[model samples]
Target: MSAINKVLFIAPRFHTNQIGIVKALLNEGVEVEFHVLIKGPTEDYAVLTPIKIEEGKFSRFLSKFLKTQKVNKYYAFPSFFEYFNTIKNFNADLIIIRDPGRFFSIVSTIIAKLLGIKICFYTQETLEIEAKNTFRYFFQKFYKTIFHAEWITPIGGTDTRIKKFLPFVVESRFDYLNETSAIEGYSSEKAVAVIGKFTARKRLIWALKLAQEFDCKIKIIGENTTKEHATVYQELLEYVEEHNLGDNVEFMCNLSHSRTLKELSCSNFFLLTARNEPASISVLESLSVGIPVICPLECGTSSYLTPEKTGYTYRQDDYDDLKNKFRRLLVHVSEDKKIRVECLNSSAENFSEQAYINKFNYIFKRE
Candidate 1:
């Protein structure tokens, strides 16, 4: 077998999917190193080790500006230096970067090309015509530059939309099927669970409102990131208090990934109300635990969620639709043990981690 000695992964944040990919590559005997442009402590991976590039206050301020501008040009100088230094030091064979949406990726791609390193771009969002602009022009140019040598891998339900713009080397869903075995039986509960960052776009207030109306408990697990997030959380808290839902709605902040998974295992159901999402790992993780997921049809994961079989998908931003769906799920809660088992079985077959790895290997070996 041809050897894949070293790989450098650049990403915005660490998630289970990213860790899973690194773990798989390590199992295949690849030396993996990660470079995070933004700094945050992450879950430790047994297969891969991560190295962070220390940033000065000036550079950090500039990065924030560039991120807001959607122009990655500011990161070029520092990223080029870091990439060149790392390539020379590590003698890496493959350089993998996630999401061409950032300026760091553009810089990394250029440096990799100059050093004769193989390049791979892992995309999460659909590169549709709607993204056309100065920023997208540069993104498309980079896409053309890396067209031949490496691979283009996208994870989620927007494959049809993405293929319309760029040639996809491979496609994989966000779920890891290997871990989810088809388990029988489920426990009933009076409350629902919502997980993810506490942001306005997530429409978490909607879930809170539903919980209040039905006199059911709503456990919200996530952190408030920005002022907008603080405001949203505050408003929700006030609403809960005003509507006398203090006992029914509980807020838990920033549980680690593994702990979150453990929490999902016991929840009656999962709720997601994102205004937009390419794919949500939370939904997949919930499904893996055999918890029925209730989300909007526009969410990427909705494509895989078969109503009455797997879970439910309601109309976007339609409170009536959401209320009705919640009611249906509540009514069927007593009868969902068999349904949950079927959902788990079906999800296990479709979203296995081994399947994802096989698809990745095929893309990596493409001529």
Candidate 2:
């Protein structure tokens, strides 16, 4: 008998989460295929065997218009014809979509229903954000239409956002664990790391100001996503230069996932000042490396942070609160190494990679 060639994943981007899931499925002897529907080129990752759907200029224009009108235009377009052809060619038994908020998932679902294929929708964002308007309402209805699968998995702390809409399925998030045994305490010189695209929502400028106030060395890591954000990046650079914070603030652009892990391994703290974050994988990654994360309360991932334990959470947009937290951490660093160890232990216990993999396997096996 042939092995169960079980799952296919659809997404616009490939990141650590996708990489982890594919690795897990392969280890279980399950055949997996990735179908990406976007107008861009693809990156080469070792495990993600991606099937890229190239879009013409007209399709790209329409996709941009839909996104601007509302987030749900991703569902109403004709992008799924290509996706359906890809799925049919692959003969996949299970279809796993990364974010149902996109139009491709809506189209994929319709094709899956007609073909008698099971559909599993995975989202990392809150249902509230997904359904924030009328367009999203229609998108949710579209999701209900193709949600004929045995499970629905959401990775993060925002499960409550979707609990009311889809009550009869399994849910889970990415798990993190400290894999290394090198326990180095924070040095007399403080260090902070912020990992994410340099968008306005990431609040990189605020982090720079806070770094200057606390006399801490802050490393900003990520690429600029759009030309619109170029001004913000420039303004941040100007601020760092004007204040003579060249020594304290360092901007690192577009590091690979492995290189990012190495940076986090050496850092004393993780900094996330996102004005709005559905769920941050960066926080989980930080915790996995036993590095404490400091984030604003508005972030969905802040729900997992325990003050003075796993990390610190401050009120959103309050620069003073951030400064106070940094000040407290500075004091702790100077007075006690034991406090840092306690923080590391807490993060390791809660966010282990094994825990995440086991949960994913459970969801995949659900009837």
Scored by lDDT, the top model is: 1
lDDT of 2 by residue, 1-367 (tens): 2234677777775555556557666676668887665422223386665766655456667755555644323534345566567678878777876666566666677788878787777655544465566676566555555565543433333343333212111112122223433254676454688887767778788888887776779998877656856777888899999999999988887677777766876677788888777667677667656677788776756656667776788887788888888777666545555644565554444444444445555545543
Candidate 1 local lDDT, 12-51, one digit each (tens)? 5554556656765667667888876544443545545567
Cα displacement (angstroms), candidate 1, residue 122, comes to: 1.8
Q: Which ten residues in a row have the lowest lDDT in candidate 2?
A: 165-174
Question: What C-alpha lDDT values do all the predictions have?
Answer: 0.65, 0.64
Model 2, residue 340: distance off in Å is 5.6
lDDT score of residue 138 within candidate 1: 59
* Residue ranges of candidate 1 with Cα displaced over 4 Å: 41-49, 55-79, 127-142, 145-153, 156-190, 225-228
What lDDT would candidate 1 get against the real structure? 0.65
Which prediction has the highest TM-score against the true structure? 1
The regions of model 2 sitting more than 4 angstroms off are 1-5, 39-44, 56-82, 127-146, 150-182, 224-226, 333-349, 364-367
